[model samples]
Target: MKRVLGIGLSLVLTLGLLSGCGGTKAPAGDSNAGGNAAAVFKIGATGPLTGGAAIYGNAAKQGAQIAVDEINAQGGIQFELKYEDDEHDAEKAVNAYNNLKDWGMQISLGSVTSTPAVATSAETFKDRIFALTPSASAPAVLEGKDNVYQMCFADPNQGSASAQYIVDKKLGTKIAIIYKNDDVYSKGIYNTFVSKAKELNLAIVSTTTFTEDSQTDFSVQLADAKKKGADLIFLPMYYTPASLIFQQAKSMSYSPKYFGVDGMDGILTLENFDVSLAEGVMLLTPFNADATDERTVNFVKKYKDLYKETPNQFAADGYDCVYAYKKALEAAGCTPDMSAADICEKLVKVFPTISFDGLTGEKMTWAATGEVSKSPKGMVIKKGAYVGMD
Candidate 1:
C-alpha cells in the first residue's frame, strides 16, 4: 500500500576495502573466463531457525527460498544458498557470519532480526561484504556501513508512522504502553513513539515495562492501565509476549483498543492461541498478505501453496530483497565471481534511479543511506486475518 512516491536519493557508497572478502577479481580481459555462468554466486543467509524470534526468521528464510527457486529456474547465472541458524543471538549470528565467509560466500541476505543484524554487520562493515537484510530495522545496523542495506524501514520511522496513524485515525488521545525494556528493537520504537505522540499532544496515561527474562504475568500492568482509564494500549513487543499479554488481559477483563508495530506481526501464527484474540488489533507494517493487488494476490497464493501458511511482512521483504540484488546485478552486467568490492560498487551504482515493483506490492526505491524509501501502511486484524485499515 505504501508505494515509494518519487525518485529517491542516489545510492553512492564507498566500501572501504575488500582485500579480505575472497581473493582478487579476474583481470579485465578475462571477464567471462573466470566468472559468469559457470562460477557460483554464493549467497549466505542467517536467521533464528529455533528460538523466540523463529517466526520472523523462518518466514524470511522461506521467502528467500522461494526467490532462489524462481531465480535458479530462469537460469541467468549460477547461484547457491548457504544457510546458518543464528538463534536470534548476536554472538551466534557472528559465528554464522564467520562460517559463511569461511565457506566462500560473497553476498549475504541475513541476519534476519535487528539484534543479530547489528552484530553481524559490524564485521561485514570491516570486510565490506554486501549484505541486504530483509527484516533488520534497528538504526545500529546501518550507522557506519555502506554495504549493509535494509528492506524494512528503521524503528524511528516505524514509530513515527504509528503515531501518525493513530492521530490521523483519531483512535484515542489517552495512550498506555507496555514495552519490552531489555530488547533493542522494542526500546528503539518506544522512544520514538513517545516523542512523536508528545509532539502531537497525545496524553500518556500509563507507562509500564517488562524485560525478556522477567515474569510473563502482565496482570499488574493491565490493572495499572485500567486504573488510569486508558482507552488505548500500545504493546511494543514481539508476538510471543504480546499473546501472553492479550490472554492475561482477557482473563482480567481489561479490554482496551490495542495498537502494535511490526514486532506483533506473527500473532496469528502463535501455536494453540485463539485467532479471535487478535481481532481489532491495529498495527503498522511493510506488507499485508491479504492485499488485492495483482502482485500481492499472486505472491500470497504462491507463498501459501509453497509454505502452507500465509506470508508475513518479513516474508514479503525477503522476497523483495533478492529481486533487488538481481536487478542490480543485471544492470551492472556482473558475473558470479566478481570481487566483493566490485559487487558492492555495482550495487551502489545501479540501485539509484532504479525502481522495483516488488513482491511487497509497492514500487520501491533505494535511498543513499541504504534504506528503502517506501511508506508504511496501517493494517487491522479482522475475521482472523489482516486487512487494510482504510
Candidate 2:
C-alpha cells in the first residue's frame, strides 16, 4: 500500500509540472514571449469607439480588420490588431495611447479625428513609434512629427481642391461658409478654403460659425446665408452638424446647393437621418464605392457583407493605411521581431520610396513631409447613394 501511494504522488507532481510548462500562452503584444511571436506583428489604433463620432472610428476599425484578414490569409505576412476607445476627447486619446504603448504596439493607426490625433501623435513622436493616421487631416497632427504620416488628404489640400472643383465644375457662384469655429479640423479647412477662394476670385457672400456647445441649432447662420442671397453653402464640418444644418434649412425653406469636404462623408449613415435631405449634395473625396473596378467591387461587397452598410471614405482610408504600411514594411524588409524604434526608423526611410495602390487611391506615394499625393474625385448624392460626378 505504501509503494502504490508513492507512485500516485509522483505522477501528480509530473502532471502538474507539464501543465505549468505548456498550458499557458504569452501576452498578445509581447513579441519575444515565444509561440509564433516572430511570425506576427502587433498593431494598435485608437478612435472614438463610443461617442458621437463612432461612425468614423468603427468604420476604420472594421476596414482595417478586413485588410489584416486578407493579408494574413495570403500566408506571407501576419498582423494582430488591437483598438482602444478614445471617445473623441484629446485627453482620453492620450490615455488610450499610453494603454496601447503598454501593450507593446509596434505600429500605430493614430486617432480617427484631428484633435485626438494631435495629442496621440505627440506621444508617438516621443516614444519612437510610427503612426499612420487614416482620417486625421489637420496639418498639426504631423506638423513636427517625422514618424507620423497620413492616409487622407490634409485639410489644406482638401480646402484648395474643393475651391478648384467648385470653380472647374461651375457648381455655384456666390458661396457662404458655415464652419465649426472651435475645432481645429474645421478651422484649418476654413482658413485654407477662404484663401483659395479669394485667389480664384470666387464670390463669397456671407460667413458664419458655430461652436461645439451651440451646434444643435443653426437658425441665425442659415437665416444670414439665405438673406445674403448665397447660391451655394459650403460646410467645413463633421456630418453631425451638417445633418442638423440640412434639417433646419429645410424647415425654414432656405435651400441652397450644399457642398462639403471629407468630414461630410458619413452623413448618410447617421441614425434616423433622412437621406433625402442630402440629395444633390456634392463633395470632394478620394474613394467612391460605386466604382466598377474589380478591386473596388470586391472590397465593397466584402464590406457590405460584413458591416451591413456601404463603406465610407473613412473606411477606405483605414484600409489604405494598412496596405500602405504593408508595402513600406516589405520594401524595408522589416521583421516582426524588430523593436518599435527600429521599425519606425526603417518605415521612415522606406515610405517615401514606395508607391502603394489601395482601395482609396492608385499609385499613392508619401512625401517626406508626411503628406500623401493623390487625386480627389467629385461625388454627388443621388437617389440616396453617392455617384461619381466626374
Model number with the top lDDT: 2
lDDT of 2 by residue, 1-390 (tens): 999999999999999987666323334423234444355777899999998999999999888888887777676667778889999999999999999898879999999999999999999999999999999999999998899999999999999899989999999999999999999999999999999999999999999999999999999999999999999999999999999999999999988999999999988889999999999999999999999999899989999999999999998898888888888898899988789999999998998888889888889999988999999999999999999998
Local distance difference test, each candidate: 0.81, 0.91
- lDDT of model 2 at position 92: 97
Lowest-scoring 10 consecutive residues by lDDT in candidate 2?
A: 23-32
Those runs of model 1 whose alpha carbons end farther than 4 Å from true positions after fitting are 1-38
Error of 1 at 381 (Å): 0.9
lDDT string for model 1 (1-390, tens) is 133332221111223233234534333222122433235566787899897789888888778767766776664654566678999999999999999888777778868888898999888878777888998988888888878888888888888888888999999878999988878888889999999999999889999998877748888889999999998998777899888888888888888999999888888987898989888999988798877888788888888998889999888888888778888788888877687667777776677667887866467887777777887778899989998887
- Error at 146, model 1, angstroms: 1.0
Residue 385 lDDT (model 2): 96
**Residue 313 shift from truth in candidate 2, angstroms:** 0.8
- Candidate 1 lDDT (Cα, 0 to 1): 0.81
TM-score of each prediction: 0.88, 0.92
